[model samples]
Target: MIESAYIHIPFCSHICNYCDFAKVLYQKKWIFNYLDALKKEIQLNYQNELLKTIYIGGGTPTALDLEEFKYLLEIISTLNKQKEYEYTIECNVESLTEEKVKSMKQYGVNRISIGVETFHKHHLKIMNRHHTKEQVVEAILLLKKYGFQNINIDFIYALPNETIEEVVSDLCNFLKLDIPHISTYSLMIEPNTPFYLNHIKTIEEELDFSMYEKICRTLKKNGYEHYEISNFAQPGYESKHNLAYWNNAFYYGFGLGASGYIPEIRYTNTRNLTKYCNGEFCFNQEKIDFKTKMENEMILGLRKLEGVNLIQFKQKYGKEMDSIFPIRQLQKEGKLQVHNRYLRIPEEQLYLSNEILMQFIDT
Candidate 1:
């Protein structure tokens, strides 16, 4: 059964230079119509299963005004949730308000993931993020004041012309928030983004690697678990919604530009807002064949620190993992390892995971 759902709210007050996600500037004129379309889409797709997690991600879900935000929450309330469900909403410091926090608390949103990419003023300007460090601190304090402790802040490292000290300083500022989760990402200049259009270059490969290493060391030393490749969290605070994706589990994705996996089909909604609002929900879908399923099993499952479970693999696919792929060979090359019956990429080799995961393709 699909136990997770991700809803995308594709409206932001300001677009970040590095963002490539499907989103548009917030317009009050479009808010009600978009929410109505979102409600229709969810009603059509959701099977009424009790979901363990529901993540409302962005283009800054908090960009909506209080009434609009509450309307969005009302639409989400239709989903049947488990007894201990985790409901998360993405926020930006500038858009998040005290009234919205109270609304989220009342509507059962237990998790808040903020897009505080960098605390450095120069980096913030470069990314077109306009929030001050004080605003971020105030947002966290406000969330905490409302008893919302399962907070997460995104951190970006390895920007163009960024220094190691700057990265470390950002980390220090994040530490002061004392939140439970941090999702760190190395800057990638994707096509069509403002960064790519402006010819912004990434930092050197070696320096990027060093920054990743430093982040891992510091977060680990400070009692955070490097549970996934790009996620660090205090124990018991891991993102259940994201874990569903990495585990290759089925989920419902509602709203424009969202992608979902359900049973044998994986689908993405239309990126065109006009098309989506007009009820043209699906843009593309691919049937998951057996070969592709097994490949995804390896590629996605190995992302976790514990890796994939060897026994579960056999039980699920009715074949030994080594029989289907080059598991034994990768193990011999020290790219993979078996620890406590879980097959995983060794911690030291995780940075090269993309290269290693490619081997499973077409195997």
Candidate 2:
């Protein structure tokens, strides 16, 4: 009953200083080559099943010019899908033109995720993002003008030296936009990213925690549900595509650096752009072990505010919660609770979610 797909686009007009995703500056010759390789990969990876959701994400999907975009869409729309499948594409403010927005609507994309990172010009400059604040506004307006109603604007807090006051201000600005959904992320400095290599500091842990609390309060006050730790949405606007990932549902992923799970096997495509461009790197898969699979089920389920359904877990895994998870101990420690038949991590404990989730990891 699970149906989803993920496509990774490895080209970006310019790389962000904080980005660690596998990507390269655009070279037109590889455009057609990548399209061919991606099509072949899809053909090799999945059969025609009803696709409930498809997400085209990466180095900036909107980086492709109009002609190239049409070609890419033509290749992607071939996935087997139920009527009314949700199709999401990630875009950069600078790359999403009015023409591109219209063309996306024409091509059947139903969701648009724009990377807004932050509204402060100083933060954008420090992050080395190529777009200005005006571009972000313009992009959203264009999408709305083209009748694209489902929009998700992504933001990041906890930048080095960011104050809690500043974080609240940023959230207020985004709230004013009337966007349907917002994804707010903490700044994690990954090794090998430009920021990490240059030794850029992250926000102080105390300040970061304060910032997170500030965001939760502001979003709730603005009538957005803090459904997932990182996602805030107006009622009924949660991201269906990403929910598939968090719920550990089976999905087919194609293109460079995409990861997916189908039935019992988990797979990750090659990180090297050259390997991904040749159709030889799509099926590097590893079969899931009992412990790894169980850990995934426990951890991924905890990402939602509603948490794991006890009855559904038993139904899916053929095991009782008392036998599998340390649910009782966590409840005693005030980290988690079972309401009705669902186990949920407490809201305040969410910022330290990794610690709570790891308690259930099977060795």
Best by TM-score: 1
- Over 1-363, each residue of candidate 2 has an lDDT whose tens digit, in order, gives 559999999899987888888688888888888888888888886788889999999888889989988888889878877787789999998878777878788879989999998888898898888787788778778888888889999999888788887788888789877899999989989899889998999978888888888888888998999889899999988999888888888998788888889888898888876777766775478999877887888799899998989999888788887787788888999999888889999898898899999898874
Query: Global lDDT of each model?
Result: 0.94, 0.86
> Candidate 1: global Cα-lDDT?
0.94
How far in Å is the alpha carbon of 98 misplaced in model 2? 1.9
TM-scores for all candidates: the values are 0.99, 0.97
Which stretch of 10 consecutive residues in model 2 shows the poorest summed lDDT?
A: 274-283
**Candidate 1: residue 249 lDDT (0-100):** 95
Tell me how far the alpha carbon of residue 219 in candidate 1 is from the true structure, in angstroms, after superposition. 0.2
Error of 2 at 347 (Å): 0.7
Off by over 4 Å in 2: none
